[model samples]
Target: MFIDTHCHLNHERLRDDLQGCLERALAADVRKMIVVGYDGPSSEEALRLSLAHPGILYAAIGIHPHDATTWNDAIAARFRELARMDAVVAIGEIGLDFYRDLSPREQQYRAFEEQLRLAKELDLPVIIHCREAYEETLSVLAAHPLPGVMHCWGGTPEQAQRAASLGLALGFGGTLTFPSAQNVRDSAMCIAPEHLLLETDAPYLAPAPYRGRRNEPAFTRIVAEKLAGLRCLDLDQVASITTQNAYRLFPKLALPP
Candidate 1:
């Protein structure tokens, strides 16, 4: 009962051989995955994939902060339409990313607030992607209080506690398996189990054994295995806990038959 709370099945490699990817994930016991979007077109593609795959693949639609320059009332309206789709569960992978700063800081701020407002209005949970902008992200969340997961969380234990204070769950990924990710692991250790979520951010952060290779949902098991060690729990315990946390956060995730 594993759930990859964040991934990019819409990415070229996975989308090109989508059915095969699904089989591999299921074979690895991945029960569900969120195909996250970083832009309008990507959101549409994510939704398309989810609609096709139904219960197993779900969508989180939003423009990532890197693409915040695309923000506007018209685009906002279009995103609203997409949110209405059944398979679209949340408004995300959205938040600040000072590390890359691909968009103007001011533009990122505006787009982040705008999308937060949209999430507030639509009554949807968020999927935040904060990197080196934890405080800035917290500032935005302070203004708009919507519950969600901190997708790909990379903060200290204090920051993890701070995020938990704001009703957010910490997303632990392949980085947990990295020798240098003791910081992330420290954060994971401090976070209460109820505030933990497991994600692959697939086609990106593959766990240690597959690091540097293209990541896939099947590798989510590697992440779970690593987290199980960090938390001193068995693999099945970690899976059940994270899967329950995911369903609680994204209630729209259809249960498997």
Candidate 2:
């Protein structure tokens, strides 16, 4: 069985046929999925999905940096309330996204810090989304005490090393399947199996064969294949290890029988 450590089932692409998408994923041996939320509404939707899906799906609630501009105490309070839900496994797809600059850098930092504190307070793991702000993200993480995974890891070997040092598992996705994404692939190769997890970031970063198309949890098998190739291991071995790693990070997930 495989685990899609990060995905957005609450997004519009998957919302229409959520059951079908999950069926296809299960057919492909993708047993468990962590549906991520980026903002208030999405986070609530993620929690609702988790409730509907029960053991098959779980949730991670947080506000994305893009919505940082509108973030306030009320939103944080809502997240804290959601975090108390049994199905809420982590506090995330949260972090810095300097590439988009949708929200001011200061606002992003403020939101990130607040969420980090929330995770720490809730004693829940985090699923961070960082883009083009590795150093700044790392700096903030360094100043905070939290447990989490770096979702869709797009960092250099040095940064991966630092994140691993802080007990943060490095999440690999379809980006590693790209031939030109040497940095991401190298980072994947550098991470130890125990400190690594697999994700698709669906319907976003689809793997090679499905490149340019909408991604799905089923495509996570391709990600496992890539990681196995990069690590010189078998597909089943990679799947087994990554699945175990994900369970380690999010103990709320019920493992496949």
**lDDT tens digits, residues 1-257, model 1?**
89989999998877887888789999999978899999989999999989888899899998899999998898889989988877899999889999999999999999988898999999889999999999988878877888899988888889889999998999988999989888899999988899999888989988898898889888889898988988899999999899889889998895452
Tell me the spans in candidate 1 whose CA falls farther than 4 Å from its real position. Answer: 255-257
Off by over 4 Å in 2: 255-257
- Residue-level lDDT of model 2, residues 1-257, one tens digit each, is 99998999999998998888998999999988999999889989999998998888899998899988777999888887887778999998889998999999999999899889888888899999999999999889989967789999989998999999888899999999788889998898886678889899999989998899999999889899889988999999998898888888897785332
Residue pairs clashing, model 2: none
Error of 1 at 1 (Å): 0.9
Model 1 compared with the native: what TM-score?
0.97
lDDT scores in order: 0.89, 0.89
